[model samples]
Target: MLDWVASLPLWQATIFLFVVVFFRAQLTFWLGKFMRKGLIKSKFGKSGQNAEEKRAGIAALEKYGWPVIPLSFLTVGFQSVVQLGAGFLDWNWLKYTLAALPGYLAWGFIYAFGGLALFRSITNGSIGLLIIALIVAFLVWAVGAVIVKKLRTNG
Candidate 1:
């Protein structure tokens, strides 16, 4: 998949990626909207009703506002949550799209260039480099996980 995308013309690939990201955020937003009512009626809904959760979410919104949309793109698994949260909170469409456009472009560029670079490194038999990259990635993940854990616990 990376190879196929990397082989496309730069502009074409970027457009394709931007569309994909846009649709993904839209889909997630709608999903959240659809699920919010149902989830709130469920047994697990108490968590969302908690004062702490509400306060934390509000604090985050006050601190980050729409910027979280773009920042979320840098994380691997949290973008969906951010998009869904926007919908659940009833964020304005124009604001969400405006924030997400740059994020999608950044995501496109990163995937296009980084994917191609990784592909080249693999094809060139740079096993040691790949291993080192994997190790570094693992360490980063570990540190991020710890930080998130601490923040959650502290908050």
Candidate 2:
């Protein structure tokens, strides 16, 4: 089933990307809002000046918004957070969309084209490259998860 889907034409892919990006942006926006709420309720944040702190968070989010899109591609939960943060902080949605779209395309091309290139190179050789790829992806996810968990727990 997925193989059939994978063989989709360029138009399908484009539409798919659009839909995915739209929903993802919405999700990110809400995630930021909820995270703000959670932070407010948390012990560390509760004792502080809530309005000032919220404004600071919003400011920090706007300042560092675009980079988060690409960084999220590598990290555990960055994608959603970036979306949410930008949304809650009222960053220009158009700019966020533009920045995130190219980053997403670059990421897809890197992984997809890289995989195909690797396969072509390794066609008559060993499976070491494939194995290494799997291992690296796993390690990336694991490390990202740990970092995200730690940040959430401590922040």
Candidate 3:
């Protein structure tokens, strides 16, 4: 898959990425919608601490609105959660789609360029560089997670 994508023109690869990410996000949103009822009844539903967490999630979404759609892309696992919350909350479809455009574009750029670069580096026998890059990526992710956690706690 990486080879196939890497062979494409940058513009084509970016477009392909945008389409895939956008559709995947939309699919996740619909899945959230479909599971809304079950989610309400399940463990993370309206019972105990889960209820408070749910309320917090809803409040965050409400506080941020459509901007959250795009910002969600920056976080690894949280994007789908936000999309699900958007669907479960019944946010306007047109607004969600429109707001998602820039997010998807950013994702496309990152994946297309970054993936290609990583693929090339690996194929060229640059394992040491790849290891360093992975470590740096992990550190960045860890820092971002900590910052997000602090924000969530303080907000």
Candidate 4:
């Protein structure tokens, strides 16, 4: 399914992944912004403990978010939180964009180059461990899915 990405030249692949990361981050940020705006428009965010918590959360995020944004890219789930939280906190555009750009570019280069290298190594000489790891991963996912499905049905 993802073979075409490997076929692309390094520069093209880098650009492609860069755009992918850019759009994904933008979308995640906007989604949070939209939710925040909707909450503001409605009565839900007007006055409450939730509102106070939200305010405090926003303050803390603003104070620390710039530093965390770059580190977020190295993670999986935490990346989304940092990106979305930036928007939820109504972070300034320049600050957030500047903070996030390095991570985005780093991801682009790492994935574009590291992924190609992995595919090459797997195809060329190091298939044994890679295949075993992939098989184990698939088995784990399949087993976990079946268990979850059964639990859902029983519950």
Per-model CA lDDT versus the true structure: 0.72, 0.58, 0.74, 0.72
Model 4 worst lDDT window (10 residues): 146-155
TM-score of 1: 0.61
Query: Local error of candidate 2 at 147, Å?
Result: 14
Please, what is the TM-score per model?
A: 0.61, 0.48, 0.61, 0.66
In the range 1-155, model 4's lDDT, one tens digit per residue, is 66688689978888898899989998888888888787777776655536554556556556544777887776545678778877877787688888889989877877787754664566575665567567656755764476455444443
Which regions of candidate 2 fall more than 4 Å away from where they truly are?
41-46, 50-61, 74-78, 84-95, 104-155
Checking candidate 4 for backbone clashes, the offending pairs are none
**Each candidate's clash count:** 0, 3, 0, 0
Cα RMSD to native, each candidate?
Answer: 5.0, 7.4, 5.0, 10.2
Return the lDDT, model 2, position 11.
Answer: 54
Candidate 2, which ten residues in sequence have the lowest lDDT sum? 107-116
lDDT for each residue of candidate 2 in 1-155, tens digit (9 for 90 to 100): 23443466655654554465557666776677677667777887687735664565555555544676666654334456556656655566577777677656654543343334454566445576566567667865774576455444444
Can you list the residue pairs that collide in candidate 3?
none
**Index of the highest-TM-score prediction:** 4
RMSD of 2: 7.4
lDDT tens per residue, model 3, 1-155? 56798678888989999999999999988887778767677876656535565567556555556776897776555788778877887667787888888999988877777754664566576776677677657855874576467448746
| Candidate 4 Cα errors over 4 Å, as ranges | 49-56, 115-155
